[model samples]
Target: MSSVWHARCAGLMITSLALFAGTAWSATISHAAAPAAAHSAPAAAAAQPAAPTYQHTASYQAAEAKYNQIRALQVQAFDASECIRKKDCPSDESDMLRPLEQALVLKRALETAASAGDRDAAYFRAKVAAEESARFNEEADIYTGFQDPAYKRSAGLAYERAVRERDFAKNMLVAGAIDLHPWSCMLYADLNMAAQPGVNNRDAAFNAYYCAASGFADRGLKDLALKAYAGMLKTGHPQHPYVLDMHSRLLNVRPDNPWRKIEPSGLVRQPATTSKTSHH
Candidate 1:
């Protein structure tokens, strides 16, 4: 499909996902670690040549197709979210329903590709898992984790999925973060803040956000730096004593920043209003 189609699809996906507030999707990546060496490494190395790169495999092609689809779905989802923000969304339920249904189809395709050991598919799966993990965590908060049995069970499932997916997605993100990849740093921050079991580390979250913000600033991407700062604040880590010092640097960042002019409608919290009554 063309780039325009991809964008439209992504917008649709974003719109559908946004229906579940506090679960917005974001871009992310991961890096896998090197396997340990075998005992007879020298002999094995002499007997075998390196394997071919993925570009030469059919799995690569399949992954590329799924990747494009995922990107398109993400774009469409975002666009749908934008429509809702502008209050221009279609009132008809199907307008929203169809794209969501399409997302399921794409997800199945992604799974198929991943089962084939496609790298891109694995990455996409991890991204999807990360989003789900964050969503479940937010939902889990309402029931306070161990409070309600039914809610706990449901949330537990989500938590499990998120953890598995994050693990699947971590390698790439770690690699990218190390290289100071802005998106990677920000994504790593997001994954950390999901508050999933064994994944909740305020210090690490603080560092990832700080890395992203400082890196952006160094590259003169003031707008991105501001966004990163906002992420840091939103991640519930603002009170971390170690991160306290950076607050001053980003104190000026506001919910109305121009960098996110196209942000989703609910991205910023609106102030409460009071109704006044008059008696004659």
Candidate 2:
């Protein structure tokens, strides 16, 4: 399939997942309707606390605006690349490189701000690096079919930097009493997975899967978490002891039947748990 098609499919899948999440959330609210109705109006309002809001600093707002502009250029670059692939539009590969260079410039500026303790800049910088890394990988796939080691190495380094910046941002935000949303946690897991790949990075892969599973569970997506755990066990990529430890932890915290017991080899004894969750 063309890269454009893949991008379209991914967008569609994301939309579907959003719908699914909304449906699941509605179901959860419905299940609590009876108990919620038992309380008086004021008591019910108190029980269901309002969502907290944060005020962004002026510096953060300025940085965010620049980030948005950079992202728009990045999307144009992607479209240009796709046009080249189709051979249906007058496009130069240089069209793609120009925006990437701009992104790098912005990334450097953000780095400076991040060093001065700007958490929002740090987050935007991580996002730019991650997207740049993904674009590098996509270029290699579309043009060289993974035959270029330089692209792979560059992608890996960019992803690694993204993870570092994102971690720093998270720490800074937490210290400032800012709570991270579930999507932020999921993005961290994605960065980890992108940074570490295949058998050579088993420990890193384990960390990625562990992060993903735990984040999903904490977000009330236990079924998705179980699927992540199942992928870990089926691959047998992680250390046996670590797998066993994770199994035990899941059983204690989530308490699902599939994680009820573990085998000597650290594999779940029960049948594989399935999730209805869809992904791009």
The candidate that achieves the highest lDDT relative to the unseen native structure: 1
For model 2, the stretches where C-alpha displacement exceeds 4 angstroms are 1-63, 76-104, 145-188, 195-199, 205-280
Q: Across residues 1-280, which tens digit of lDDT does each residue of candidate 2 receive? A: 6999999999999999999999999999987996677656658658896655444569779778878978887788888888888856777889988988887788678778877867667666666656655655554445444557876776566555545554554443332222333233334445555553452544544554565566555655667677667756754555676467667766656444543675456754667888798788
lDDT of 1 at 67: 58
Q: Model 1 over residues 1-280: C-alpha lDDT tens digits?
A: 6999999999999988786553332221111112224435656868897754323346546656665676577667656766766656674445555676777787778766655545455545556657656665566565555676887787667666656767656654675577676656777787777655565577677778888887766666668888888777776455765246456555545556633565577778999999999999
Poorly placed runs, candidate 1 (over 4 Å): 1-68, 71-126, 135-155, 197-200, 231-280
- Give the lowest summed-lDDT range of ten residues in model 1: 25-34
lDDT values, one for every candidate = 0.65, 0.63
Clashes of each: 26, 0
